[model samples]
Target: MTVMRFDNVSKVFYTADSETVAVDDLSFEVHKGEFVAIIGPSGCGKTTILSLVCGLMSPTEGKITLSGDKKVGYMLQRDQLFEWRTIQSNIRLGLEVQHVDSKVNRDYADDLLKRYGLWEFRNRYPRQLSGGMRQRVALIRTLATDPDLLLLDEPFSALDFQTRLDVCDDVYDIIKKENKTALLVTHDISEAISMADRIIVLTKRPAHVLTVHETHLGDIDTPLKRRESPSFAKQFEVLHRYLNGGNAV
Candidate 1:
């Protein structure tokens, strides 16, 4: 049930004078319906990995595989919604881009808006919605395409602390309810601990898998609830130590 696999994947950027290695021998697997988070220090090529998966960039050496013909939907740091487009039109952007803007896809998009409580705002512009709601719309737009795997590239980093929390819960609920597989790249240790089923830690530069931890907090339904769990602090400390190059067990 592995939706995606990275086998010794390496990515290098070559300029006129020098070549910078962004990823080195990276290997990871994301299974069906699982939320996996990649955490590492800043400038660790985390975004490069997502680009590789989405076919925006090819690996310099090694292979990247997706099960069957799984399509990947990327939710970026910003909502990236067109200011001129109404919510309804914005939701259909992906479908239109993919040339699949048929009745069925449009209906599915409307259904998502309704289910997520954004139906009332369908005629409104992105400026009319709050930051959190805008993020929701962006997610729904991504879902409109019905991608097999989702790539979340720091999707909530732009939000304030409280809004980030609320949006995290909403996004997690939607993803779980839709039974979608997600791979999130985040620098927030607590965010990773709260939302991910497994956390993949990477090295500083020329990123590679440093370690992996299975978050045993799946039973705690929401991100806020998971944050309140007694083990939250302990897990955060473990990840923190790893990022700081401390020996942690």
Candidate 2:
């Protein structure tokens, strides 16, 4: 099923007539339970595309439709958890706000914490957890509401290289295990290649779809494995050229 779509979308920005065109005539569709990554140079309006999907910003022109008005969950570069709240409390905050707190929901939250190895630290503050664990908590917090789709904006960009890969594995495991569709926006081609079933490359500012590459990573299905794959290097160079505004080499 088509879970999300952008039909000839455009986003225009006017700051005292600055009039920047963020996205120009972009059209695409994301199917259910697929991982679609959008990669482009800085100022290519990748985040703007995500904003339109989440209803944070409306498209200046064209139509965007969600399959059923499903709730969207966004995970940013930072974990963004409160330092004051205990892990359990942090997870429960959404339920509290929605007035849906109940024995079942709280138990579900506890199950996720325990399954993800945060159970022992459930009473600890956010500062007590490592960066990866904290990110996991942030993801669980987003999952608490059970959104139909997730928009991740360079969610691992803030971490060190090793930590980022390990966290990528962690998040990949979680999201796949739960069978959630994810739309990831990042500037890193390797990260995109490793995480996504398909990749959508955009142009410079006033962006349009440069290309969309569908990948089949074989038995070596991992960020690291994909990077190590023989095709990985060639694909990266192809994307590198695309972002540079040349024909795919």
Candidate 3:
């Protein structure tokens, strides 16, 4: 079943005497439990797509629909954890915000920390954790709200190369294990190819769907494993060409 659908959606930004079109008549569907990544040229309004899905901004035309209650969990470019709060406290922050902080939900959040090997660090502040660990905590907090879908906006961009790969594996594993649907906006071609079940490539300004690629890496157990597959390089090249405005081969 489809969890979300953007049907010919377009977004426009207006100033006193000017208007700019960001997304234009774009349409795509994210199915339940599928990981979809969106990649585009810089300034192509990639982040704007996430904003639309999360209801931070409304589209100028067409329709955007989300399945279930439309509950979305967003993970931004930074970990965004409060340095003053302990890891556990940060995880509960979302529940508290929604006025749903109850024993059951709190237990669920704790269980995630424990299951993900974060129990030992629960009492530690964000400052104490490494970059990858901090991102893990951020993912836990996002999951605590039990969102129907996750919108990840360059969640690993701040990390170094090695840390980014490790965190990519960690995040991908958690999302798959939890059976959650996710839409990621990223600029890294290899990252998108490895982590996404389907990748949607967008055009430059006035962004629209340029193409979509479905990945089929046999016997790949994790995102890291997918990267090891010989198909990885091929897929990366395909996405690279498309991002450069070249025709898809």
Candidate 4:
């Protein structure tokens, strides 16, 4: 099933003096229960694509469609957790905002916390947790709302190298375990290769699809395991060249 579709979508930013096209004739589909990553050169308007999907912005031309009544949960670069709120409160924030903070929904949120090993820190502030743990909280908070599709915009970019790797695995595991579809936007080739089932490579500016690569890393279940696969380096090189102007093979 197609969870989201972008059909010939284009987005333009207009200034008083000039107009800039961020995305041009861009098109893609994110299937249900699939993890799709978008990777491109710096300033390639990856985040703009996410904004369009979440209705923060609309495309200037063409159509953007979400199947049925699907709700989108966005996890940004930083955890963006409120320091004043306890971890439990942080998780409930979304439910409250959406006015779905019923007994059943709150129970589901608690279940996620317990299942993910975050139950112990329920009363702790965001600052009390490690960077990795905080990110887990962020993911749980996003999940608490029971969104059908997730938009991850460089979700792990703010962490340190080692923390990023560990958190990448954690986030991937959570998303898959919950059987949720996700669209991630990142500039890291290796990160995209490790986490995404299918990767959409975009052109420089006025971003459009350059190529889409299906990562066939067998039954690898974790990002770290995917990175250690023999095919990992090979796939990385292919995407690296695509972003650099070399033709896709």
Candidate 5:
């Protein structure tokens, strides 16, 4: 099933003296329970697409549709946790914002923390957690609201290489465990290839869909495992060439 669709969607920006075309006739579909990654050249308006989907912005032309009344959760490069708030409270923040801080929802939030090995740090502040743990807390916070689709915007860019790898596995595991559909925007080709079931590559701005690659890393249980696949190098090379104006396939 298609959870989201962008049909001939175009987004234009206007200033007093200038007009910019960010996305041009972009069209794509995200299926239910699928993990998708979007990769493109630098400043190719990848983040803008996420903004449009989450209702932070509107498209200039065409339609953006979601399956039914799907709720969205967005995770950015930074964890953006409140240093002063305890970890448990931070996880509860989304529910509080939506004014759905009912007992059931609160219990669900607590359950996530407990199941994810974070119950012990429930009383600790964001400052007390390591970078990776903080990112996990951020993921738990996003999941607390029980979104239908999750949008990740270069979420692991802030971490060191080792920490990023660890966090990627954690985030992927949590998302899959919850049976959530996810769309991730990353400049890292390797990261996209490793985590995504399908990858959407975009052209330079005004951005449009270039090609979609289905990663065939069969039975790879984790992102790290996919990275270690023999096909990983080939996939990386293909995506690298595509991003650099070379034809794929």
Candidate 6:
């Protein structure tokens, strides 16, 4: 089922003398439980796309709709967890706000922490945990809300290379195991190639949909394994061309 649909959506920012068109007639559909990644050149309006879907901003033209309830959770590159809050409290804050607070959801979050080897640090403040663990906690906080769609905006860019790999694997495991749909925006062609079931290639500023491709790494599903697949280089090469606006097929 198509849970989220964007129909020729366009966004233009108006100023005193000029206007900036961020997204130009972009359209796409996200299937339920699928991981769709959007990759484009820097400042190509990828993050703008997420804002439109989440209702943080409305399109200047066209339409977007969520077939079901439009509950979205956003995870930015920075963990954004409050320094004063413990991991447990951070995870539960969303639930409390949504009024879904209960023993069941609390237990579920606790189980996730324990299962992911974070239980020992549950009472620690965000500053006390390692970068990878903090990002995990940030994701857990996002997930605790049980959002209908998860929007990840380059959620690993700040980590060192080694930590990024470990966090990427951890996040992939969490999202797939939860059976949730994810839409990730990233500039790393390799990262998109590794993590996405489908990849959307976007054009430069005032971005429009140049091309969309269904990508796969055969039956081996781990992000790291996908990166190692022989097809990975080929896919990156193709994506490079698309991103360059050269026959974005």
Candidate 3 off by > 4 Å: none
For residues 43-63, write the lDDT of model 6, one tens digit per residue.
989999999989999999999
Q: C-alpha displacement of 220 in model 1, angstroms?
A: 1.2
Deviation from native of the Cα of residue 34 in model 5, angstroms = 0.3
CA lDDT of every candidate: 0.96, 0.88, 0.93, 0.94, 0.95, 0.89
**Residue 152 deviation, candidate 2, in Å?**
0.5
What tens digits encode model 1's per-residue C-alpha lDDT throughout 1-249?
A: 989999999999999999999999999999999999999999999999999999999999999999966688999999999999999999999999999999999999999999999999999999999999999999999999999999999999999999999999999999999999999999899999999999999999999998999989989999999999999999999899999998678
Index of the highest-lDDT prediction: 1
Show where candidate 2 strays beyond 4 Å: none
Model 6: ten consecutive residues of lowest lDDT: 213-222
**Candidate 4 lDDT, 21-114, residue by residue in tens:** 9999999999999999999989989999999999999999999989968799999998899999999999999999999999999999999999
Model 5 C-alpha lDDT per residue in residues 52-130, reported as the tens digit of each score? 9999999999899998667999998899999999999999999999999999999999999999999999999999999
Which ranking of candidates, highest lDDT first? 1, 5, 4, 3, 6, 2
lDDT winner, 1 or 3: 1
Q: Please give the RMSD of candidate 6 to the true structure.
A: 1.4
Candidate 2 residue-wise lDDT, 10-118, digit = tens:
9999898579999999999998889999999898899999999999999999999998657798998898888999999998877887787998989988888888888
TM-score of every model versus the real structure: 0.99, 0.95, 0.98, 0.98, 0.99, 0.96
> Model 1 segments beyond 4 Å from truth?
none
Per-residue lDDT for 61-90 in model 3, tens only?
Answer: 999999898899999999899999999999
For model 1, give the RMSD to the true fold. 0.6
Which scores greater on TM-score, model 5 or model 6? 5
Candidate 4 wrong stretches, greater than 4 Å: none
